[model samples]
Target: MNRPQDHLAEQDNVRRVDDVTSALEGLVTVLGQEEDLSVVLRRACLQAVQAVPDADLASITLVRDGGHYTATSTGDAANRIDQAQYDAGQGPCLEAARTGTVQRVEVSEVARRWPEFTAAAGAAAVVSYLSAPLFIDTEYQGSLNLYGAGGDGFGALDAALLELYTTAAEAALRGARRYVSARETVGRLRTALTSRAVIDQAKGMLMAMHRVSADQAFDLLVKRSQEQNVKLREVAEWFVADVLNA
Candidate 1:
């Protein structure tokens, strides 16, 4: 009981949704393969650059100490200029991160509001800007900044496009966090194995020194470790050092 025109509209809507979903899936697949954080950030910045016209460049900064952020990856010349904003902490990039607000400013306008950042940025010939925040929680809001050197820095339509890129960037950041955790876990596991091996070697030295069974040597090592309130690895190290000194 539907008109053909109505059916076509519904199909169009479905196609739009499908396209967005497909793009998102592709982002996940590509980002998941990236082992390094730099590679992930680099891809995210480029994605944002493509989503918004007039955005001559894009960059994503990582949180750092001193209430500051660093440009981890930059998409182009304007983005490289944006790095000075982070170095100075007084432009749309800093403003976006701190207030979690998108800011658009002409080079002249920003010069008034952010003298230091604008001054530093102007030296690199950047003249316009638009920035969005990156949020891990999706609600807390952080920063995803875009830059340009012309008046056409951004427009109303650009906002919607930027949103798509920002969402993808957030997912990429989440993926990078998982990658970091996995590598850390693997490193910890290797350290634990190494610690156990050293402890066993120390245990063997104990058996030789005290002329005791292997089990008795291990028990003696454990008892000493507990009594001294030292770590098993530390106890093993001490034993090795003492034997060497003797």
Candidate 2:
């Protein structure tokens, strides 16, 4: 025996879930097109603010070698609060990142736990806070935080929504980092190959002009490079340039 109200409530819940799924799908598409890690991180924070209904502000905090900093934040308010925690060496965001756990702080009890963070957040009218730890094995560790301005702050549904957002964010960020690294490696390899090709061309030209062996021509290039105190690649390039102009 299902009541009409219960049926309507179930329908609304389904609609909310659908909306969240669609939003995340859109986020995946957007992130796929981005190659910069910093842009990806900032987009993740902004998306968190939009995806979670109760989230008024969002930010990310990263920890490395016992040092921590706010990677990106939605606004000055969020950064100010995060910096207070980093300065005082205590806050929900820091604790969540260090312990790899979720931290929830209510305005009423925040003062008792982290007095310094509370003072800063209170001035900005932040009434509630939630931090979800993002961990990818032992390599990457950080926390995604959401701030609420007033009312009851965040309920179970809000926390659950934030968890889902963080899950997607972590995946997108890791993929972006890998893509950037691979692109940089490819760029370096290409430059090395180009340099080698130019140097070989210069060596062949020297051997043909001087009627010398490959070893003797290479030794001559090295001698010129040493005499000019320049890179072997530069000496080779100069010789090739001169040949081209001649």
Candidate 3:
């Protein structure tokens, strides 16, 4: 027969699972609607704090090129704590981002592991830290960091839940990044096509007016572009406009 405490524990586990599911679903929905990565990250930070019971504050550390910075945070305390790590040049968040692993540390261990970070975080009354690596395609590597003020700190279960959440968050970030990249490519192609059409029309006009060959007409446009120090497309557009007006 199951004990009463065991049944209560089962209920708590089920509830936590549901909460995590809901948070992940919400993050997916937000990612689908927002093409701006900044907005998506900010929302993710908020959801992370809400989903993790032990997290008092949340922030995201993004590493781009060769530098790392906090991309988003739930509040000033989170930002300050994150800045402490960046200034110290070593902390749980940086370690997680660098190694692509999780870092869960209690207050007692923080002093020994990251003395510089300990002083800053201690000032803010932060006693626990949890960081999970977040990889978004090849452009960004980051970590989702959670700070806890409670002395009890985070448990194994809490770390497991955060890892699960970050895994889902990474997938959503990858999809969003790909979508944004594709949209930009399409836009550039459209612009190129439009420029090509304008240039072709100008070439046809020059060929007719000057009774010149197609190559000669193109040369005339290039000459004007170089003389005016303007783009070939601009010269073509101006020529077309002048001919139409004539």
**Best TM-score goes to which candidate?**
3
Evaluated at residue 123, the lDDT of candidate 3 is 73
Determine the C-alpha RMSD for candidate 1 after optimal superposition of all C-alphas: 6.7
lDDT of 1: 0.70
Q: Candidate 3, residues 76-157: lDDT per residue as tens digits?
A: 9889988988888889999999999999998779889889877765577888899999898777788999999885899887
- Scored by lDDT, the top model is 3
Worst 10 residues of 2 by lDDT: 134-143
List, residue by residue over 84-115, the lDDT tens digit for candidate 1: 77667678877777787677767778878988
Estimated TM-score for each candidate: 0.67, 0.87, 0.97
Ordered list by lDDT, greatest first: 3, 2, 1
Model 2, range 44-131, lDDT digits (tens) per residue? 7887777776788888888777888888899998888888788888888888887877788787777899887776555777888899
Which residue pairs collide, candidate 2? none
- Give candidate 2 regions above 4 Å deviation: 3-12, 64-66, 120-122, 135-140
Q: Rate the local accuracy (lDDT) of all candidates.
A: 0.70, 0.82, 0.90
Give the candidates in order of TM-score, highest first.
3, 2, 1
Note the clash tally of each candidate: 4, 0, 0
Q: Which stretches of candidate 1 lie over 4 Å from their true place?
A: 1-26, 67-69, 136-142, 212-246
